[model samples]
Target: MSVMIILIIVSLFVASGFLVAFIWAVKSGQFDDASTPSYRMLWDDATTQKKINKQSSNHKQKSNGN
Candidate 1:
């Protein structure tokens, strides 16, 4: 049927679009750091808190001196 042929063409276009997007992601280094993300969450909180504390202490010191 003509409807079936149209459906096949539409499906092929959708499949090719997905393939192009996947290839672009591979070329763009999207998957290059796969392992880092799993480990980052474990250490990010501690490092972020340390940075915040350091900045706050520096601000307090400058305010007290003035």
Candidate 2:
């Protein structure tokens, strides 16, 4: 039907728009650090913070209890 043909054309136009935007983003370095975020998150920042906090709290408790 004519309606189906028009729908297909409209869908293609929208998909191409998205494709162009994706290409533009890639060229602009938007995807440059895509892998780094995944790996960086695997490095536990909380552990280091907790260690520092524990040391500081221990020092404070020792200082105040004396």
Candidate 3:
């Protein structure tokens, strides 16, 4: 039937849209770090905090000198 043909065409278009979206996501690095993010929460941030504190202290010393 004509209705069936139309439905098939619409379904194909929808499927193709999803495929294109998936391809675009892959090409744009959407899945580049699948493993890192899962373990990111377990990583220690103490070093980062130390660096930030040191920078702030240096800034304060400069301001006091000026």
Candidate 4:
């Protein structure tokens, strides 16, 4: 019974620490550029088929010892 109380207190303290850290991160601008990541993900054009084809050709040359 007493161990349960100690466990609850420790759990609450750990949870509070996490909450404080998250709040500190928010205040420190960690989540400032929310839209940038989303837009960057969508705007990235480097994944086009042309680039992949070139990479594949390079790998093929390496495999052929050329």
Candidate 5:
């Protein structure tokens, strides 16, 4: 059908747009630190963990008062 032809053209345009955006991101160093993010989660500093625990406990106490 004629509609199928138009749909295929539109889909191709959309796919090409995504490809261009991905290429731009690569050139812009958006993915340069690829491995650091994966390792970041494993390096949990103790001070930040203590602060998070303190905040959560405070939040729980405040919520319980309601």
Candidate 6:
């Protein structure tokens, strides 16, 4: 039927759009840091908090100086 043909055409277009997006993602280094994300959760939260506090204190000092 004509409706089936139209459905097939629309499906092909949708599939191609997805394929193009996937290809673009691969070329754009989106997957380059695959390992980092998986290991990031294992980092110590205390260390991160300390670093953030230090940076904020530095910023505050600079603002107070100006």
User: For each candidate, what is the lDDT?
Assistant: 0.96, 0.92, 0.91, 0.90, 0.93, 0.92
lDDT of 5: 0.93
| lDDT, candidate 2, at 54 | 99
Clashing pairs in 4: none
lDDT by residue (tens digit), candidate 2, 1-66: 999999999999999999999999999999887688877765668777889999999999999999
Candidate whose lDDT is highest: 1
Location of the lowest summed lDDT over 10 successive residues in candidate 4: 41-50
Model 3 sits at a Cα RMSD from the real structure of 4.4
Candidate 3, residues 1-66, lDDT tens digits: the string is 999999999999999999999999999999998999767765547667888999999999999999
Error of 3 at 6 (Å): 0.9
**Shift of residue 56 alpha carbon in model 4, Å:** 12
Model 2 TM-score relative to the real fold: 0.65
Model 2 Cα shift for residue 66 (angstroms): 9.3
Task: Estimate TM-scores for all models.
Answer: 0.68, 0.65, 0.58, 0.61, 0.65, 0.64
RMSD of each: 2.6, 3.2, 4.4, 5.0, 6.6, 5.4
lDDT of each residue in 4-66, candidate 4, tens digit only: 999999999999999999999999999998889877765566556668889999999999995
Q: Which stretches of candidate 1 lie over 4 Å from their true place?
A: 49-66
How does residue 44 of candidate 3 score in lDDT? 47
lDDT pick, better of 3 and 4: 3
- Candidate 3 accuracy as lDDT: 0.91
Q: In angstroms, give how far residue 5 of model 1 lies from its true place.
A: 1.0
- lDDT winner between candidates 4 and 6: 6
